[model samples]
Target: MVPKQTAEIFQILSKGNFISSNGSQARLHDCISHDDNFRILKEYFAHIGYHLESGHNYYYFSQQDETNTNMEKKLEQFAHFIDVMDFFSCLDVKPVTGTRYRVTQIAEECFANERLRQKIFALSRKDKLIDKVIEVAGSLANGGFFEQEDEDTYKVMDAIHYLETIISLITIDDDGEQKNS
Candidate 1:
């Protein structure tokens, strides 16, 4: 029989969100990771055209065929993620799984560091430093790479590996060209 949480899994993954092992929905993650569940869910989702794909301690859905519009939108979204990851990579506290970050603290860091301030300014049009930080953090949170614990604190989720993996796969050519495989 299919897992009891099949509907719950479908609800989240179908919306393009991940069930990350370190996020609030970790129970759902555990459900998917259990023996036979992945195979079962993969078959179930496949019948409906979604391919249930697993990443490092996380699960999401992918479509076998995507329209050009969807592909373009995803490329745009990934480009935004590149900038967001760049900002996070420069932080004193890296964006590893389970790492918690506070907006005010990050804003203070940006206030003290001209480089960080410039990076965040490029990412957000918000007038306030704190708002700019919030925009970046909120983007990640909305994308399932981070989960907001409270009003000000957000914790990185295991799904962040998806971003890291994609970013790491990118390479700069000898002619200063960027390429992704």
Candidate 2:
């Protein structure tokens, strides 16, 4: 039988969010990684209808099939993420895992570049440059790709590789075409 903590772990992973080793919840991550605990939890969760999955220093849940509405929502969310990623990529700062960035730094960069400011405006509903930076960074943090280290600083999480991997899988075909599905 799985321990109560194991059940609690399952509940967290069941959401699309991730559990990271170096994240704020390090204790929970360590608890999940303890000797033979992952194996036991995997088996127990399978019977209860969840497939436990792990990635580099993180764990999340994935299922075989999703409903049409669920798929649509995910695809739309991914589209938004792709735009956010493109905006960040345009910045000199790359969003590689473990990179630390400050809201003020990004806002300063945006203020220096009209194109960057435009991109930030598109992604953010906030009016001020700093607020826009905060909004975008906050969104990434809420998505589990970044961890807030302090009031205005964030460190990218290992789970960011998940988004990068999905983005890399997106391909444009020959003859200026894009693949569907």
Candidate 3:
């Protein structure tokens, strides 16, 4: 019954592996974000040993478990994801969430602007501006922080909740080195 009701929506979300409010795909995007439908679907997903979590206009899963062997590995992945998230968070306009971004566009901007160039330089040892920008953006995309829109275009997506959760964890982390001299 649950699967039937949400067959189309689930097919798209589960396959593309994204149910993005910040996506350019109109039908799938609107289906998940719609209030009444979201409420019903959220309840249905909870029955499958995963709780649905909301983050800034996005949704994701929170597995319910007592003993998971991969917890530490997951934590390490999240740490890396958090660093990548911070990089995106620093961008002005939040990279215009869900919008397509081109490596050349950013590289061109960096070449024309001192601040952007500095930011690119800060990201890598790669001398070429385009390569440096793509390296940073690609890492985030690999981590599910962004989705490839096409051969050269990428779009931020709802799965960014993974990064948001990591950022929240770091925000309250007390295990930092003391700076006192």
Cα TM-score per model = 0.94, 0.88, 0.63
- Write candidate 2's Cα lDDT for 1-181 as tens digits: 5666875676667766788877776677777778877888778788877777777788777778669999899999999898888888888979887789899999999999999989999998887999988888888888888899999899888788888889888875677566543
Question: What stretches of model 1 exceed 4 Å from their correct place?
Answer: 176-181
Instruction: TM-score winner between 2 and 3, please give it.
Output: 2
- Flag the better candidate by TM-score, 1 or 3: 1
TM-score order, best first, reads 1, 2, 3
Clashes within 3 Å, all models in order? 0, 0, 0
What lDDT does the true structure give each of the candidates?
0.92, 0.83, 0.64
The lDDT of model 1 is 0.92
Worst 10-residue lDDT window for candidate 3 reads 10-19
Give residue 45's lDDT in candidate 2 (0 to 100): 80
- Please give me the total number of clashing residue pairs in predicted model 2: 0
Candidate 3 vs. true structure, TM-score: 0.63
Q: Encode model 1's per-residue lDDT on 61-132: one tens digit a residue.
A: 888876999989999999999999989989999999999999999999999999999999999999999999
Candidate 3 local lDDT, 1-181, one digit each (tens): 2334376655544442555666645465566666676777878877765565566666555665755657887777666565555455555536545656787877776677776666668767787877787788887776556777776777877677655555556544456877444
Which pairs clash in model 3? none
